[model samples]
Target: MGTFQIEGGHSLQGDIRPQGAKNEALQILCAVLLTPEEVVIENIPDIRDVNKLIGILGNLGVKVKKLAAGKYSFQSDDLDLDYLESELFKQEGSSLRGSIMIVGPLLARFGKGYIPRPGGDKIGRRRLDTHFEGFIKLGADFRYNREERFYGVEAPNGLRGTYMLLDQASVTGTANIVMAAVMAKGTTTIYNAACEPYLQQLCKMLNRMGANISGIGSNLLVIEGVESLGGCNHRVLPDMIEIGSWIGLAAMTRSSITIKDVSWDDLGLIPDTFRKLGIQLERRGDDIFIPSMESYEIQSDMDGSILTISDAPWPGFTPDLLSIVLVVCTQARGSVLIHQKMFESRLFFVDKLIDMGAKIILCDPHRATVIGHDFHSQLKATTMVSPDIRAGISLLIAALSAKGTSAIHNIEQIDRGYERIDERLRAIGAKIERID
Candidate 1:
């Protein structure tokens, strides 16, 4: 496992740019398999999970080329279908949760898609029922091998579009079904679909590739099936979760930081959500400017109730950044309740913050109450193990704002999301070094 050694209690300066949306890149990469022509994608994040999916694509005989940094072209004119059933594919597909997305496009075009159970963060029980259910609704035969944890979808007669009301507004699930529906024989309508900016970007990209999709920014998507799709150039939006993390980092470390080209309109409720915690963030054009804050207070709810911050679907606060917000609140001037309704085990990392002298009550697996120290009592740095991608970044933020130097082990989790985060932090005058 790799480690990060960080010296805390030092403020940062200079500007940073958020990487391309990781979530968007995952969906977009999978979308490339839908067409035979060249599809160019820009602003792809250089993170582990994204790269893993790209590697899987390459292994499947897709012509992959790197035009430049954060730019690539993929042409899936010919694919090695046998690789899908090979042991190598089983291992590779099982290693990445994002790999599940490839199934939809493959099933749409190739009439069959098979994959082993995908692996990801151990935050909670994330089931694949939604994806399979959507496929079944589209007239695909779904089969599972429980002992091997393998899933397969096949439609030898070709997929026929149909209406599907998803059980949940799952981002990946929505992307998968949309990809499958595009090449189906008829119209497909999806309700309760996830309408996050990333999903919207995917929809727009598919449209550019010749799929007729409506309701770009809403939960109800109407897709008219087309026989085939051509390739088009697509650029991913800036990652909103990373932007939120940086905003929280600036507030906690009392740093003056500028995040450039953030695509503010696509960020939904992220900026305003931070403002509820009394963090002063301003929009200078497309960039976000967070000034050095000695102390920021949590805003109470109207009618004099305690403030509550929770995650919801698009236009709602994102669950991915809740970990960052939770860490930031440890140093704010007031109290807030963090209700992580999406995942049961996400808030468990608060125990490490409690170890660092932050006042937090782990109300349950789903909720926590935090009383900010308001910088009066800075955290005492200590050794910590990164639990997952979001939690690791949250812990890193807490470590950077603490009193002494701290060591974080298993930093591979952080790398799974952030792109060369140590180098980026060093550029912003942060005292961070990576150790293998």
Candidate 2:
């Protein structure tokens, strides 16, 4: 239970680099299991969830070596398939949501894959039906142990590719299915697949590993099954969610922060989405420069309607940054409606911000209306407990812009996403300290 004691009302300066994408790292790391050759990956973020996945891979007998900082080589020449049935494996696999993805690679490379029901943030009901259903469609036998709360998929007769139209555009589901289909007998087509940059990165990496995949940036993906896949080198993209968080932080604290090497091209709808909130940010080469300001104004629609920001699949705003968007609107000049379509519990964190004197109305589990203070009133710092990763970072941003010092406990949630956040913040002149 780590705590962050932050002194508020100070503007930050200097440049901060965004970490490698956590989501991409999870998918790419699992792809290493598909081939027996050495797969080298760079720009891996040092975070709790990612480290946990790597540890799980090591337990399953993948050869992992840290070549240098933020770079590693993984070889899956010999895997301990028996480990998947162990109690120790069950305990480890059940703790991470990313563990669900490993099942797909294992099922494709070997005859079967078994895993305990995966766990992660208590955001909402994230079912595994999509992943398993896709496997069953590809001629795999599926079984579930309700008493043990476990899932298993086996294709002892081998997998054959087929077309699948997903129930929903679930990111992990699409990644899982693609990995399974990459080595199937025939061609596989996926419609309504998630085309987020991270997912695209996974598909492109699979292509580099000798998997035939097309439609790189579109919802429709075509995969031609190959007999075997070879290892390849890949570098994960900069985390767009962290980049958005820093943008929000700079606005809330009136800081002039430059986020370097942000991969501006891949940040679809992120920059323009923040621009709708009237935040002034400039693109200088590959860097994003957010200037210090006393206040920013939220822009209404052309027809004089209140601005409504909602999350959707790729081209739309990312659900991960919606928490930061809600927080940034707290001090804006006008009001905005935040509609979080994916997770029901994400908007629940607004009550904590309200306690800090920000005016917010929680309409329901999925919707909230925020009336900005326009910097007329500063947030009153107080002690709080972090609920999840995105909400924790949003609360930290609020604390940084508040009138007094605030304590944020259970910062491990924040650590699961952001890498060395406190140290990075310190380098940028933020008044933050960690208390163990």
What would the TM-scores of all predictions be? 0.99, 0.99
Q: Any idea what lDDT model 1 has?
A: 0.94
Q: After superposing candidate 1, which stretches have Cα over 4 Å from the reference?
A: none
Please name the candidate that would achieve the greatest lDDT relative to the true structure.
2
Q: Where does candidate 1 clash, by residue pair?
A: none
Looking at model 2, report the run of 10 residues with the lowest lDDT sum.
Answer: 119-128
* Tens digit of per-residue lDDT, candidate 1, span 303-374: 889999999998898999999999999999889999999999898899899999999999999999999999
Error in Å for residue 70 of model 1: 0.5
**Where does candidate 2 stray beyond 4 Å?**
none
lDDT string, candidate 2, 205-320, tens digits: 99999999999899999999999999999999999999999999999999999999999999999999999999999999999999998889999999999999999999889999
User: How much is the lDDT of residue 359 in candidate 2?
Assistant: 94
Show the lowest summed lDDT stretch of 10 residues, model 1: 157-166
